[model samples]
Target chain A: MVLRVLRSMIGLLLFVQVSVASAVLDIEIIGAGEHQIPIAIVPFGGDDLLAKTINAVVMGDLQRSGLFRPVDLAGKAPHELSEVSYPDWQARGADALVIGSVALQANGRIEARFRLLDVVKQAELSGQAVSANGDQVRAVGHRVADLIYEKLTGDKGVFGTRIAYVNRQGKKFSLIVADSDGYNEQTVLAQNEPIMSPAWSPDGSHLAYVSFETGHAVVYVQSLYTNQRTVLADFHGSNSAPAWSPDGKQMAVVLTRDGSSQIYLVRPDGSGLRRITFSGVIDTEPNFSPDGQSLLFTSDRGGTAQIYSVPAGGGTEQRVTFGEGNNFSPRYSPDGKGFVYTHFINGKFYIAVQDIQNGQVEILTAGGWEKKPSFAPNGKLILFASEARGRGILATVSSDGRVQQHMFTQSGDAREPVWGPHL
Target chain B: MKKLVICVLLVNLLAACASEKPKEVAAAAPETPAAKETVAAEPAAVAVDPLNDPANILAKRSVYFPFDVSAVQDADKPIVLAHGKYLNEHPSRKIRVEGNCDERGSNEYNLALGQRRAESVKKMLVLGGAKASQIETVSYGEEKPKATGHDEASWSQNRRSDIKY
Candidate 1:
């Protein structure tokens, strides 16, 4: 028993230190956003190296969004409002301009002060000082970008968010958490067995995912801070697809203990086990509504796999998808106005969204090996799994089906990509 | 020195008894000298388990299914039934049925379909006289595939269940 405890302690230590210094994913953006904002970000004045790093991060974030076109500065660098030259920017067709400065504080913290100016009006739109530890230079840059993006686009920026995905190379599978830009990749769990369906808790403090290390599919909730994990469900047969409620108190999981894949609700502590669906068929991938009053899932009880909605307390299930192909992996938009899912037709899967009120479906991708569509917290982009060059890669498309991005990992086939909530 | 001589005589007697009934000696020889003696016996007189014998039908362990279908087809029913009979006769043995799927549907959906395929085999095994406790079922979804190709030929090979002892 003492040896077992020591072995587990060693295992815990290995898990906590499992962060891999992997190459940042190569991203390809396609289809420019409608009405792209022409913005020029001037290099900050203080701390040349620090300013360059911050500017690079901020510029990369805006470019990847495909919603902004960078204006050429032509060697124009302004540190303050007094040094600003509005006529030149206007002549260069820049709608807005951004200027920032970074300084290393005596307390070992880095401070970045930035401002967004409406060039046509020659007035300041927004300005603020963002500060963080020296090690969190990227965080400060993301914050500055968020403020700029919100001020210009009138939408909350997601550059500060993170995403979770599973990287499978041969038989070795790892659950990874990385920044939304696919940098700072951290391996939450790495094992020889397969890991699937990682769902972030509502608070983003924990991740509930399915791991097969126990000889079967079992759901585990692991703390992102302590690297501690507890088995949320290990019932006989498969226990997978753990989706937390919006309130974070309860989670929905698919279990085969009583025969057939069915959805069940249980508290975060594994108590209050209750079966919600009685289809006696394949009913998996349960995602909660934003209000926590209902769940959207994929079921095949109607002779074909399609999306459906059922109340949180287990009542009549209403079909949500109809027409040509089958749909799977339905995730409600953040506003609960519509849902995004994978539409499988003609042996290909495409990410599609449907308006709940009008029931109008819009195909967001050209269609190929795409699956597991999920919405970003802001509902501006939908992340999904896609295949490129015969390897699984993470892909995202804007809600309007215009802007798309394909992010390819360096080593393994990245699958099951889920965008986390806004930080 | 006298005890060593007696021990040698006892070993010789045990070896003689093991050669006469290798099966009984092999069955009873757990951490005993007779187990090694039984291993030395002639192969012709020893009994081999059908599961390990390549020529036996029980050695054929896999059951295939059509896309999105869980029912065991007639072609693979015999293999599952053979394992069921083997498990019934050998009550001490237990087997696990691992289900797999092609790379077409969502991973979670494929996991459920794979599980249904495994459970379908388990149901047939129980019907063929194997006890429910003797069988365990698991689904690997599309995580494990026998063929990596994207065509139908490879997908058909991947949509299968393996009965492992």
Candidate 2:
């Protein structure tokens, strides 16, 4: 099954590269749950280009979520709610049906309407209409998917969100932002130096990262809109590992100017520098808790690298992880109930999540060189960097580890993925 | 003819004795070759800077460390000491110690670890009579790896502190 899926993924990747002007990430579902929601998405009735593109985008979003298995409609689509045949969808093993239509208005605007139906009950669940310009048809489709996903799952959808990651090809490194489904990739910053530790601000307007452009590690915060950036930390020694506070007013960074690697809190403009952790050993990778009262970091004060927590203002450090192998890059879940990190054991690295209240560790991935796990805004999925086919690839796993998907780029290695907040 | 031969032999003997005396003088003043060469007739050898001399221990710039370790090992002490001595002798010369780590753990933690490694070497250089101001330390973490392979052999080669003058 895995081989067959991989072969299809490769074939689709080649087709996408040759046929499409705007390239997209190729997703390969690694594992699936025993039961998947079967849904049928009827092609939106329109001969225009925008309609077909929106239809494909909606289906792709649902299929990538791993929660719904889209059944092939075999060119049979309903243009409106009255045309949808509930019995036909049910016969094709579709528990739910989606019917939509897109039309170009006389004012040069695109209006899209979709309806969700229960095949068994033969009842309409919900319906909504969204209008946008021709350029925003993709985003309109994502919004439609979001509505459908929430109606069925009782949770907010992440299809409309974005993710930021680093892509390295030869001597060039670029920071790219793409849709949650790995489409519409845009390189925000491209340089000849190495970029690491990309952290999105609370408002998702800026990204603070470490760059080695000046022959040393310096932290910089770049604005996604203005295309302007400011040097956050450029101390004498090494300034790296920039993590934003939950409120977006302050940032936690690792600096070695004073002495060993210690955590320091600095404003976004690089002022009001105050040391937070006073550990004699290495203290780095500071991440603010969801409540913004404590900081989770990795330290080797106990002779081995482990996750630890200290008061955001400064206090005694407490070790939080006691599992075998080393744990690093701890990121709090959206709700702050748990945190995810990269765990190394038996010569293999895995992504794991630990409950904050009970300290119970649950390994989410089997075994791969996985690192830098960042939770989605809803906290239902975790995006991380893993090695596949001897190259780095971005992957996502359901928080419970039931479903897995790999997002591979055609060129270069993709790593250090940080899921953006809901816009 | 015999008198001429005897006179020539005496002159040759005197030249040999003169050469033997300079050899004894060169041995007596072993540490001051420049001064001894000035007094001799042969052209003086060019002075080679010890720092640039491959035969000198100061030429060894990289001080390797064990995996995830920052402490300076005993085997690498000689190289550090040679650099320390050179820095002390030439107080005007400034050196920067770059700390690096293998690609294993988190980049931030490795940055901290690399800083520790660089600082440890800087501390040792200071303790060995080099001025604190003459040396600067920077940790490149795993960003500037000397080896790209993901193995013990490559990793060991990458975990090091290089002294740049």
List DockQ for all candidates.
0.59, 0.54
User: What is candidate 1's TM-score for chain B alone?
Assistant: 0.72
Worst 10-residue stretch by lDDT in candidate 1 chain A?
A4-13
The sequence of per-residue lDDT tens digits that candidate 2 reaches over residues B1-165 is 322322232232223334333331122121212333223333222255656544334556888889889999865665676567667768999999999999788777888888888898998887666999998888888776777788998999889999999
Please, what is the whole-model Cα lDDT of each candidate in the order they appear?
A: 0.84, 0.79
RMSD vs true structure, all candidates: 11.1, 11.1
In candidate 1, which residue pairs get closer than 3 Å at backbone N, Cα or C atoms, i.e. clash? Answer: none
- Reference-based TM-score, model 1: 0.89
For each candidate in turn, the interface RMSD (Å) is 0.5, 1.1
Per-residue lDDT of candidate 2, residues A209-228 (tens digit): 98888878899998876668
- Candidate 1's displacement at residue A237, Å, is 0.1
List ranges where model 1 is wrong by over 4 Å.
Answer: A1-20, B1-46
The alpha-carbon interface RMSD of model 2 comes to: 1.1
Tens digits of per-residue lDDT for model 1, A1-423:
235323322322332435656556688888888879999999898999899988988987887777899999999999899999999999999999998789999998888988899999999998888777676677677778877888888898888778899999998999998777777778999999999999999878789999999899999999887888899999999999999999899999999999999999999889999999999999999999999999999999988899999998899999989998888999999999999999999999999999999999899999999988899898888888899988999988888988888888887899999999864
